[model samples]
Target: MTLSGGNARQALSRRIIDTCKAMNASGINQGKSGNVSARFGDAMLITPSGVAYDALKPMDIVLQELDGVCAPGQLLPSSEWRMHADIYRNRSEAQAIVHAHPTFCTALSCRRESIPAFHYMVAVAGGVDIRCSDYATFGTEDLSRTMITALDGRKACLLANHGMICFDGDLDRALALAIEVESLARQYHHARQGGTPVILDDEQMTDVLEKFKSYGRQPRD
Candidate 1:
């Protein structure tokens, strides 16, 4: 049942390509500015570096060991694979990860501040506070460490001056969180333009978090 083997790898590869296409068409990503990966036992299936999402095929995905070794295939694994690998290694519940510079999420990430709990819906992100990791250059160990820290107990986080990253038990949930990050970021951006955004109180956020946990449902995030 190792993620390093046969059928699991194939399933993961197809999912990666399909997810890349879906994210691209939804305008949640551009060029090859994003990457997706899924845990298959002890290995990972990730989008190939610098490849167009639209052109991705099942076999175009790259297989990498948990230690980051890659087998013969199309292209190299993404530079951000470090971040993905770290998260998968640390978060037992995380089976899939998506990183994207979606318009709004990137806009908020560049603000030099945190994305506040402006809405209770933020609870869907595994917490009311979606942290923005300290700015780190992509593909660097520093960046990986920053992301790993920011993701502590949270399902989604923004990379300072970079983009958004979301992790979930499955690809669907991961993608949902990515989309939510973008939507919430857009809402926060517009609200800031209007005036200081209203943040949910501690008690209100707690209630939302509990209710969301109870429902066990996904809302676009």
Candidate 2:
């Protein structure tokens, strides 16, 4: 099931479907509130709008242009495809995209507080802080603009007043990052109740980044 060769497109589709199902089961996102997609050549395989994750079939996925045009598909692509499409087009390194309203992450985003660099794993987000885009109506050009701004040179970002969007060179990495971000958000909230949480200094953060590089597991796509 490795997505390393010509059949990568099929692998991408299956990964999208499976991740969507797992997200639903794990309660990271419920109902049809989230969308998943992976780049396949000039096109993308995306979850269709308003479809239940449990009922999704590979064929139920939609094919669309990177510009957001629906390919010869029976279902409409996810309404948020515009944002996802724009991210892939703008971030050449991105290979997969995930949009979900994980409870704690969404809660933190709504409060206008970005996730700070409180934990070393915060570097997993590509920066000291996981930037939060300004609130914009969903599925609109404004939202797309906000997302692109927040995601510049980053692997993941929090959507203002909404949710989280995490993409990477691969689907598994993207999914794992999404989970980690949520965990950090929850930890932050709990720690704040105790007192101001101590954050790592810039030099310490840089050292951690170097260590991650040595391990060679940093998502570099």
Candidate 3:
């Protein structure tokens, strides 16, 4: 059944807050740097701009519709709301979006590099590599369009000279993917320091992608 009323709204509001706190605590985020959003009905529940995640309450979550109209709320939505909204409009499977500037990911992004297929797990982003979007001013429609194009076939992408963005079917998955992006970024940085790490060929990456389709599912008895 479709959830409604104050109970439903409050529950989702709390989830958004919790997800933000998790992002900060998990090292994928620092301070109020990152923003999070989740799909809720015809609108999206997103983090309030400039508020520290720990200080957020259920009432502080901002709910804005896809039509650009925001419901009455206690605070302003994140400045990057356009990106989150655009992601929802472009990707039917994306239920949650997380944007952050983890140390490694941000460093790589500043260098305008994408995480390559040096590791098989890179397939988790749904491509041969996590593409880096072209540099664009943050919070601008131009940036949103660039990010949308970068995310064409991937679940995540690094915002050139900005940070990283990740989305999944739910908040937990979105947050986990953000963490994974940072992990991959760190590993890739180290790999380059040692030498040109051998990258997995398209054929090998394709095989890994196929395996990921059913990874962790139990076998039939």
Candidate 4:
């Protein structure tokens, strides 16, 4: 929805805060280590840096333009706002984004590893694998560039030595995608502990991706 008026903008801001709190409650993130944002017309509504989610008020959310500028007098935006801005600038379909340091996802990212197609569910990320961005210091344009590269043609990816990021058409789905990526990371990690996981071939993943187009929706009458 477009941020056409004060009420609408305020609503989106509250949703961003709620998503941040949910991230911690769901165990996908802890403390203020993650951020959430939603596309609001030409600007984005993002969580503020250093503010605990439990204490965030509607006005505390930062309304940042895609050019990286936030409105004057507002709290500072997330330290990683550049990455969110870059994603919104580059990915037209990203209506909402969730960036979190989920335990298993971060563990894999620390090793600079990508999640391969060890399970068909890997296709949910829009490909046969979830790529890990090259390491760069957080909050830098360089880090944003690498994330954009890793996220090419995908809805989710890992930030090397950092965390995971995902997006969808709304705040809820974006948060859900983050959780799903973490679950996938955990399963992949455990699978490796047993033995080398038998990765599905590209052809198999291709078929799975095709089916996902209609995987969960109910047919219209």
Best by lDDT: 4
lDDT of 2: 0.85
| Model 3 agreement with the true structure over 169-206: per-residue lDDT tens digits | 99999999999989999999999998899999999999
Q: Estimate each model's TM-score.
A: 0.92, 0.91, 0.96, 0.97
| Clashing pairs for predicted structure model 4, backbone only | none
Candidate 3 vs candidate 4: which has greater lDDT?
A: 4
Report the C-alpha displacement of residue 87, candidate 4, in angstroms: 0.7
Among all windows of 10 consecutive residues in model 1, the one with the lowest summed lDDT is 1-10
| CA lDDT, candidate 1, residue 50 | 90
Q: Whole-model lDDT, candidate 3? A: 0.91
lDDT of 2 by residue, 160-200 (tens): 99999989888777788888888989998998999999998
Cα lDDT computed for each candidate against the true fold: 0.85, 0.85, 0.91, 0.94
lDDT of 4: 0.94
Residues 1-221 of candidate 1: C-alpha lDDT, one tens digit per residue: 45645676677788888888788777889888999999877888888889888787778788789788987645888989999999988999999999998888887789855677998788878887889999989999999998888888798999999989999989988898899888888888888897887789878888988888768656785
- Stretch of 10 with least lDDT, candidate 2: 1-10
**Clash list (residue pairs), candidate 2:** none
**lDDT accuracy of residue 157 in candidate 1:** 94
Tell how far residue 132 is off in model 1, in angstroms: 0.6
lDDT of 2 at 85: 91
